[model samples]
Target: MSSTELQDRNVAWFTERPDDSQLSADARHLLESYSRIPADDVVEHVIKVRNQAWTIFPYPCIGQFRFLDMSMKYTKEYPELLERLAKGQRLLDMACCFGQEIRQLVADGAPPENIFGCDLREEYVELGYQLFRDHDRLKSRFLTADIFDESSPLVKLQGTFDVVYTGSFFHLFDYANQVKVSTAVAKLLRPEKGSMILGRQIGAVNAATHDHKTNPTGKMYRHNPGSFQEMWKKIGEDLGVSFSVDATLHELARDHFRFHTDDTRRIHFVIRRE
Candidate 1:
């Protein structure tokens, strides 16, 4: 079959909702956006990232449940921080994929006015803004900005935030860029015990460095959790602040490849300076 045919097939499969009850308006819109994209732009390589599941299954988002499930599992590691966020603490959700975690923060009681988010993809950020329009308590705003762009809007957001948070974006940069981002994140802090979250693929025996080739478009840089830890350790040393791995959120990433076992991947982190 042609790419268009394959695209149509995938669209047909994804159109079948898991359940009307499981569907949110934003979720529906996401699915619709997926359908609207041309088959030529829908690269086969992306399917490989999730182990062909997006092509084989009817799911709207990859690892949707697993991401939240892991977050709940590692609750203890971030209790103090999460609790503080729950109590109207200001937050900046950098490179927030779909803003679900931001929603969770609002649900946990973070003030809406205090939450700010940005993404390189405008559609994702736009979706987030529309999704949270009804909630006055979660007046979270989303903007379009490339984190790597030195003059991006994010770099000029007037003033620093109370807590600058980034979950999955760290692993998408090389070690040097990660360090740059760490400094940028630090600068975004209000100079009052600021903290950020770095979640990356980690292993005991392996040192996670930059993995720049996994993405098909050659636009993303990735790292394992260990690399993130090391980056922060160096940053902490330079900044004269103590830093440590707050928790290792394991079984958090799922790869359906037959060669990998259940203990394979994780979304672990280092929480410091708060």
Candidate 2:
């Protein structure tokens, strides 16, 4: 699709929202935890913030309220992960649109000082402070910089994080740009054995680059478990760092906007520095 067509589609999607009754369990929990109170007011607040964010970037996660579903919360390793974070292990939420995951981390008792969020758009980062209503209380830092720009301020974060979480991020680019992103993430992670990257994104049963309206080149790579593993293997080889990728593909919920076709699944991945 052309750039104009993509923009029009985004505009259309921006106006869509789930009804108040449709709010996910996680969304409700977060609203109460953050004192967004009087259930009715919380629902309105979520709709307004989400609609505004959709205008900025019409990501499916934003459109479907998936941002409230913290990826780490569902992981089998959550107990251990929370323990480590509370003990001061550093975490970076890459391309963290609105820093939802970071806020969830704070809600779960992770030390705010040890959490960080980075995204290319400063607007999104700024909005996060408002959405979570924690600008003053939350100690986590939010950086604005392009991940693909080697000289961008993001480079200052190299080798700084113990865990990097990237949700609905990597699949936005083609294979080449995905490698660039993975390489950048690899650099940001600690060299210690346990440092890793984890998140979920749209994946395909048969991995391949497909036409995507968001890309200038009109293409984005979708991966299955094996292909995702291989992509990380190649990144490790190029960086001369040992790493292992464990990925799983699961059927997306029927209500998910991305579940338009049977070929699409949600890919959950963990790339560990070995």
Candidate 3:
């Protein structure tokens, strides 16, 4: 579809999205408890901010409200993860579109000052403050810079985070660019034993590059668990650092996607700096 047509379709999708009451139990609790928003107003607020975000970038994740789905809660490592964050280690949320994960971290008792979020668009970062209603209360910094741009302001954040969280990212790029992005992420992480890169993404059963309408080059790499591990192995070699990749791939259920398809799976991963 044409760019304008794609935008129109995305707008409709966001406008007609489901109510927040339909969100998963954990997600609903997080919104109600942390955001201090009444259950009656949750859906309206989510829809309003999400519609604004959709206009900025019409991503399927934004339209489908995937940000509300907490991948961290699903992981077995959540307790340890929260402990690390609560201990005052730095955490960065890469490509943090609306800072939903950052807010969730705060709600889980992680120090707000230790959390940071970065995104390419300033609008998304600004909207995050409004969405969580924590402009004054939350101290975490939200920066705006392109992750792929080596000379961008993100360079100042190099080697600063104890953990970096990336969700629904990486698959957006072709293999070569994926390596570049991974390298950048590695640079942002602490080069210590326990530091890690964690999150989830869409993956293919048979890992390979796939055509995406949003990509001008028309290709993006999708990984199965093995391919993802291999990619990180190569990244580790290239960076002169060792990493242990722990990942799992599971069938895509109806709740994970707006449309059901057998070709995709959810890949949850943790890459530790060793």
Candidate 4:
């Protein structure tokens, strides 16, 4: 659909439109091939017909529907995070889906050059960078990197950031993978000086034991946030990192989006090195 249509429906409004008139012959060929389908068909095909696209859209990707409101709520509740940015702290936006946090931080006075965002899906990252690259407020860089891949571009990076943030990415993996990711994040930070904020989905039960829900394409993923925290703590111990529970959003607010399960609640934690 058109950008206006997506925006009206509360979806990620595509700000970058490939200009057919400006394209060279090769570029035009690619554009024609890619945009062959009607706008509405493109949206429906990706959002409903494709499996991976289904999981990434309108949900964790924050591509549409009340995402902007939730982004504002998170920064509002965690003023400390914003204050840290004012102090020249470098920030890492890990698993940053649509780069809303990066945009928000820059808008809130963060030096864009000091901020970096990484996501596994290049499509999302490329779209974000293209749409947000020209903002006068941000000097930050966005990269398409996989957090779970040890040898991915994210792992190859050299410097430690003052703040590393991930929103609702931890619960997507299994317990063992969660532990691995927690340890990796710790290792990426400097001991004691680095702070990590996680917007997590927690359940009262272990994630593995919870009912498996299928995406539109039938891929089963775990959504146990409570058991997640307990297992994550043990994982931190094993990795020699000390993480503390910072805050919890008890699902009492209707403004919060349903990330995993409609019954699922949230926990926000600020972790530091032991």
Candidate 5:
């Protein structure tokens, strides 16, 4: 899709270049600490990498450097995830643009071999290597697949992961598509107590489908905590399993941006199979 068309979905696409002040401190830390970009050149490095990824896909997250946020750090489950990864338990990062969180896991002492990252586009994965400057060091495997496709590589890896992390994902789909993705995620995780799916997404006080600017005919779901739980519960029932959903919707200091509105809230969720 044209940049002009993508802009409507989120105002950041093709907008005027934002100043360095717009980059978050956490993102800066990752660039300096994990990527080893000199503190002085971090902004320049981020800009160079972001520019390359945008040419591949004008995702709002890419334009805003939201991918660098390492969302799992803020969740209550963060410490637990770190513990799980350190012990050789498997984890998968879905829609892990630039593989930022995977790098964070490595930086935090998790074994790279225990973690996996996947996205729909492989270009983002290539750019991720550039962004982190870790092509030679990081051993985490990155896969590219469509979550909704039954024949997709991600879908084929059912029951292999213990923790599935999706950063700024799920909100990109309509209700039906969201259900499909959730079902796929359910299967992707080990079907035992404590196997979990967790992530951050664009949420709303009111749950509903909204217009998708990148795809004119497409719809994206903005869910509240209740709606999100209901979705997984319905899926669990159909799959003959049970789930424990812990979700909360709240605003963040970062929400005051071109990509969000008053209705926007951060949905932090963890769904564990029981």
Candidate 6:
């Protein structure tokens, strides 16, 4: 294909064309039972929104409907997490795409106003509304801004949240940016005991930087449990706080993507402010 063709299609990142197989049962339940989408039309509506989001960024997660993969319920802390949210503690779904998890939480009794979603693209933020078909009723707030931008609107939200659910985030950058991302997350967290961060991301048995599929020199960091904890330990000391990091890796890349990476695993983690 010509460079123009590839550029226009973003074939490098948009290789996978997903169908119903990529959609999860929980997602279907949320759409049908919660969002009130007709059962017959749920798949079509999801495909349409996924394609619309594809135009913004051809992320593997979006194409595979990984955004719909709810990581909250699987966590060991889920019961308490939902309980606290229902009791008025707020949460930020950092890098939330289509706010699927947010909808699930709301469906499971967490207050919609207690949930906040932030994404770098306003289009994705708006797409969440379209995907859930709840613009008129869902009370969750979605912010469209980059966390790295010093003057971004997210700055106004620093230190206000009790929990952050950030699935498939943080491994997207190199070490420096990973620290920056963690720092940004930490800044958003309430600096008190019980402030917590939970979610999953790609990890490697050996911490390293992997080549980006789309860019010649772009790299993303993958961490082992030890390295991840060490980074957070330093961050805690630097910021005069303490933390406990629980991370583990077992699931392989092939389980989620067509392309497989050796030693890559899904790291499930919970970091708590202590």
Task: Report lDDT per candidate.
Answer: 0.51, 0.79, 0.80, 0.51, 0.81, 0.82
Q: Is candidate 4 or candidate 5 better by lDDT?
A: 5
Kindly report which residue stretches of model 3 are placed more than 4 angstroms away from their true locations once superposed. 1-3, 10-15, 19-22, 215-217, 255-261
Model 6, range 178-208, lDDT digits (tens) per residue? 8888988998998789899998888888998
Q: Give model 3's TM-score versus the native structure.
A: 0.91
Residues 65-155, candidate 4, lDDT per residue (tens digit)? 2222234334443576677777777678787765756776665566677788887777766555433334343457777766667678777
Worst 10 residues of 6 by lDDT: 1-10
RMSD of each: 8.7, 2.3, 2.3, 10.9, 2.4, 2.6
TM-score of each: 0.62, 0.92, 0.91, 0.64, 0.92, 0.92
TM-score of 6: 0.92
What is candidate 1's lDDT per residue for 107-189, written digit by digit as tens?
Answer: 55556667777777665554444433433334678777876678888777634665666665655555566687776676666
- Evaluate residue 143 in candidate 1 and report its C-alpha lDDT on the 0 to 100 scale: 75
What's the best-to-worst order under lDDT? 6, 5, 3, 2, 4, 1
Q: After superposing candidate 4, which stretches have Cα over 4 Å from the reference? A: 1-66, 70-77, 130-138, 202-229, 247-249, 252-262
Backbone collision count in every prediction? 8, 0, 0, 12, 0, 0
- True lDDT of residue 108, candidate 4: 58
**What would the TM-score be for candidate 2 when compared with the true structure?**
0.92
Model 5 lDDT-worst window of ten: 7-16
lDDT value, candidate 6, whole model:
0.82
The true-structure Cα RMSD of candidate 1 reads 8.7
Residue 191 miss distance in model 4 (angstroms): 1.8
For model 1 the local lDDT of residue 88 reads 65
Runs off by more than 4 Å, candidate 6: 1-21, 214-217, 253-257
Residue 65 deviation, candidate 1, in Å? Answer: 7.0
Query: What is the alpha-carbon lDDT of model 1 when measured against the actual structure?
Result: 0.51
